[model samples]
Target: MLTYNLSNIGSDSLYEHLYKCIKKDIVLRKIKPGERLPSKRTFAKNLGISVITVENAYSLLMSEGFIYSLPKKGFYVADLNDVQPTKQVHQETVVLTSGHTHYLADFSSNQTESEIFPFTTWIKTMKEVLKDNQKELMINSPCGGILELRKNIATFLKEFRDMDVKPEQIIIGAGTEYLYSLIIQLLGNDIKYGLENPGYPKTAQIYKSMNVHFEYVNMDSYGIDPQELERKDIDVIHISPSHQFPTGIVMPISRRYELLGWANKVKNHYIIEDDYDSELRLGGKPLPTLQSIDVSDKVIYMNTFTKTLSSTIRMSYMVLPESLANEYYKRLSFYSCTVSNFEQYTLSKFIENGHFERHINRLRNYYQKKQEIILNAFQSSVLKNKVEIYNESAGVHFLMKIKSKKEEKEIINNAYSKGIKLNPLSKYYSNSIENNNIYVMNYSSLNSNKIEEIVEKLKQCI
Candidate 1:
């Protein structure tokens, strides 16, 4: 008999819960193949659920090939020989999943200070848009994006990033992941992609899930080794040259030019420039974007407003080359923009009214102070002798090389035992880089007062 205690399945829809329970039994062969299922009326009466609920659950299962029904008879379980049960992964990783323990001072987030957001200004802008632009909000943005938001982004880019970007060249999406998928689709899967080792793992994970061919390109102090790029058959290279993630190595002009020269070597070569946090460069003069320097139309520039604005805002934009822009329209013109019109218009107003610049400035100052407090505490801590500040050039994170007599696993274990949840530099790498003592610390969301507590714990552990 189908057993479902609906009262205990809190937070799930009744029909959904029924569907899932039945599906699980079918998959596990508890309800064997070809076994008859109770009719909707009978099942509803037995379970004390509405007949429509039972019908909905059966319909879902039948639609999904989990069950089949005869015209005059009840439903029968479909053959689920192809349905394999998922296995648990026992491999050890420094990933911050639900499996990882909690912490007092979590330093593994790139989330901006939510307290610093201009909520009043944003609410006011949103209201203004809703009042006058209700029709615009109801409709979808164009294939690329709304003209107003794209134009403002272009202007912002030219002013802040020194990129000679046109509005039509910009493609707005929900976030970097969506934009990345679009990029893969636009560029075609035939090309070999090169991702930076010891870089953002999410990019690699996305590529893998899409079943695309990609390799890890090793990096140096300058950036991805130009020689390594030249030797590989990689047709596309995704990088954050302005300020490389995890490493924080800002590529110099020589390296930038060298990269451009390398991209020009092969016909149809492209460089995906992930300038994620360029505006948050807390130190040194802001360098021109890689796309700004590329005359060959090789660089694809991407950025988002999450770090400067709010994490909840999922708007991320990309600038395609002129030729590729036309190509994208020809192939993907039917695809609507991922960002909603309300958000697009609101963000446009935010940028157009100079509030965006102010927000970035305020966040830069705020994070600079936060970074200083954390860094100062680390320097003045008892564990300072064992830890060396590696890179503090850009973004809210800096690398620290821990010099300890203990093994890497033991050191990490000790830190975890002390309730210091964190990750080793090895966590980000995909085989090209060797991880020894380096670790990444993102203090953007860490409270100022918790620094001493974390440092004291680390001192005791390290």
Candidate 2:
């Protein structure tokens, strides 16, 4: 009789312990293909467990394709060659836990609160647009964008961001990622690029996939160091000046000028300024974009509706410098397709009719109140000393530096056990850095009640 020890497993049921042991043996290829498994009666007798427990383990293994049973003979190790590994199919599905209608707290992503979305007004406008512009809505828009929408965007930027742009200069695409990809293609592969260190990983991943040569520029509270640019013979710099991701630090005016001056010194170089989440200023007026200051036509401004409106919209526009706009159009005309005509028409009307501004103003006020609620919750909680909040005056998300002596993995694992999800700061850094204690928390998605719940749970977890 082959005897298996069950004493090693603590607190786990007999079936679970057996399942884990068998699963590991199969994965490590200890059990060769066609190897016969012990009969449930024999296995249970040898292990001193009930037959039902062994049967359950075998049933699970068979369901997962780790083992197979012949009609009369018995169960055996599955043929490794015949059994293909399961693959996760990617789909456009947002996974939220149901039944639990409200979460005590969640800090997953900065999404508009439920009450902030103008669903009624949006539906009314959408219906009106569909009724009035039926013909135009069915047809494909121009590659650049609908002329009216482009004009609205141009005007909005000029008034709000102080950008000097024409309708022809703007190109609308799916989102910031798509626009970045298009920009990469327009610039071609020969140029060297500079990306911020401890910056958005997606930017680096995208550029790296295109086989572009890029260097990392270390960032400080003031923003990306201009002195770092002197070390690199780079042709383009990708920057997020308004609100830096993960860190949430705003790039100061002095560094903005210095960066522009550096770009001027580097002949044939350009700056890709991603002005993401610049409109949600909590206290001061919105800063003028780098594109607004670019007299040499060296800055390519990119903005998206993902932060302001719903991320599902996937609407983004880029303001190309006059020097590259014509060439970009010629290149994009051949390959790029415009967004939906109906959406373009609706958005154009939204801006023209002043609904966009009204929506923004409402969201700003809603988020400001939400920010205060979060701040208050943290201040009153036991986690006050354990977490140091950064850049709380602006943006939808803020950084919290974990002061506990425990490892980051330990903290994350503990949080996970309590059904809380957290984004670790270490994931943002590509190069070595000193501050590994930071974590990005988004309060925009939760209500005051939810925020309190999350903070309370966090206190207990810590």
Candidate 3:
């Protein structure tokens, strides 16, 4: 039987805390493999917790594959022999009771402006989908997602990204995270991957969670330095050539060709191009995707509508090369599409009827106005001389380099003390480098009335 002291239940929910404690024990190998856990009622009686609490904890553990149950028998521990054991047992104890409402203005987030979401347009389209395609709602999405949606996406990519990909090469998934895992499975496990150093840390976290061996490729003025790729013996590389996160540097055409040459010369090497926020480019014409110029078919293109559309929509897709697409069906055909038939059909109609394109155009104009408002607010403020904005013409966020006498942590702390949330640029780097005072000032959440106030408060902190 398992044992734990339940007398001092702090702020966390009783069941969740209990679940974490048991999960920690399981990971630390305190309980032996295949050990039968005590019955929920017995455990509840022993620990002075509700039986329902115990049941919920057990259910969560079972869901996460930490334990298994037999119909006639009790629950038993799962084998963690393959799981790379960690020394630290106790996880972060402080769980926030309140949500993100604690912050006054959270500029750290890159979420789309919810105020501009096309709710009425989407609702009308969804109603139409329900009225017309009643059969689709009851069935599962196609193995590669609804064929109509895939066809519309292919057409959109041809016009929006200038990529000539067939519908068969595209696979729709729930989100970027899901697609990342599928890619890992599609490619063999014996692979060494590389992610950009000052890139989205979620990518690295996902790779680490899956026990993937990945390295951080350092960046330069343009993008991921080609020399860094040559230096490391890597099998796969994930990058955002069009509008890199936080940095907003579009890889020039020359650097892109250099990458293609590198992939072509090397055998069994591929590039994962994450063009996540490409549709939101403000002023200039949309840049050509690297997948467009790849005659050798070594680039795996990925994009997500979650950023452009509502975050809750959770629709992302990937475009694999012809060979990889064939290999996927040969091996991964058993997997059903992560998205549902109803939502997929609605999205198909939305794209087919020219609504998605119009929505994107409206967002472009909306974000451009917001961008100008925030930049002008900063320039007019007293801190204007101290803050240098970079790559403001492109994405929803711009890099704000602060010329301050204080260190990065000190500046961030001061800002937080004033109820301001700051995303320091140094937090993104996994490698040891020079201390650069940069902050990612996101304007998507910027309120025109509060822009001056936020800038003023930041001025006081700096």
Candidate 4:
């Protein structure tokens, strides 16, 4: 018979406590391999607990391969001789990583602020999903994603971005990076890709890893120059028209049409509209998406929840052109959906319940206030006369032109040594360029309270 002091179960339920206790004993060799466990009823009576508790514990143990059972016989501990003995780890000794340096201010990361996250709302929606969507959760999502999520997203795009897209056109993926690979596969590798110069580096990194032919397309004032794309003879161009990264250039309506015209000129031409971080547009009405204006079926629209929700969510999606959508199913239908059914269903409920929009409204207000506070801090800080801020109208980050004689690299390295992480604007450029003293001020996850301290530290570095 298994012996456990059930009186001190603490926060755990009757079955959970029993399960952990039994598992620990089995792991420690107190319950030897092939040793029979008392029947559920006998164990329950001995422990003064319900038989259901013992049964559940036994079932859990069996499911985890810690124990086995024979029909019409009894439960027996499974052989764990090959498994190493569990070692107790001290809390203080268990560091997640070695030599991990903590930064006072990480201006390079565009991670969402944890304080603004609607944890209570998200948790409630998730719980509701677990209770109401047990069946749907078990069902395998289609290669694109669950219909529920896609449908909600479709409706959202229509109302928010004025894009008329069918749910069938949306293909959900783990992240924008994952979807980029899918795009390369969908549109053969032979074609040349025109990437925005001084844009997000991750896109270029993805293309390089895939060994695809690509060139850096220089950007004019409007955005990625269509003339540059034509000059490069590029078949595919990746762009962030709504709000260009680092530069924060929102492509004008004229530019959007010009790019679409260029795409229409070539039979194989396609524009990957990476509309990342458009939701957090700080001021004025949200600009229309390129997909909403696209008529030539040349746009492959992509967006992610990482901006509005959390970065760890790993949920992103793309809207394929009608023809491309058909082709995707014909060619890539065998690929199972990358996101889990539970997440898909939970997001669907989040959107359907109006929590997403409300959260967005609240977030926008919070970020607007936060951005003001940080900008004001910089303006009033000791570095007030030494810094020039630009492109603070939209997005979570802006371009900061630091008035310094030191090179960008030197300034960045010195700042890092002082516990400040500064990402230089030149790092996004593919070709080598002289130091401009410009840095990308990503304040999404910045601690506003530490702004004064950071400015003082940065003063020492610059």
Best by lDDT: 4
List RMSD in Å for every model shown: 12.1, 7.9, 11.4, 15.4
Model 2 steric clash total: 0
**TM-score pick, better of 3 and 4:** 3
> What is the Å distance of residue 78 in model 1 from its true position?
33
**Per-residue lDDT value at 414 in model 4:** 59
Candidate 3 pairs with clashing backbones: none
| Tens-place lDDT digits, model 1, residues 326-406 | 999999888988888999999999899999999889888888898888878988977778889866868888888888776
TM-score for each prediction? Answer: 0.78, 0.80, 0.80, 0.78
Model 1 misses residue 89 by how many Å?
14
lDDT of 2 by residue, 1-462 (tens): 445666556645556678879888888888788889999888877776656567767877887778999998999998767856568676542333332322344566655655677788778879989899998877777788888899999999988888879998999988777788888888877888888877888888888888988888878778887777777777898998898877788888888999899889866688999887888878798677888988888999998887888766879999998868899877668754557887888888888888888888887888888888888888888888888888877778888888887766556544543446677777788865554667888777766766776777677556
lDDT of each: 0.83, 0.79, 0.84, 0.87
| Models sorted by TM-score, best on top | 2, 3, 4, 1
lDDT of 4: 0.87
Of the two candidates 2 and 4, the one with more favorable lDDT, higher being better, is 4
> Candidate 3 — number of clashing residue pairs?
0
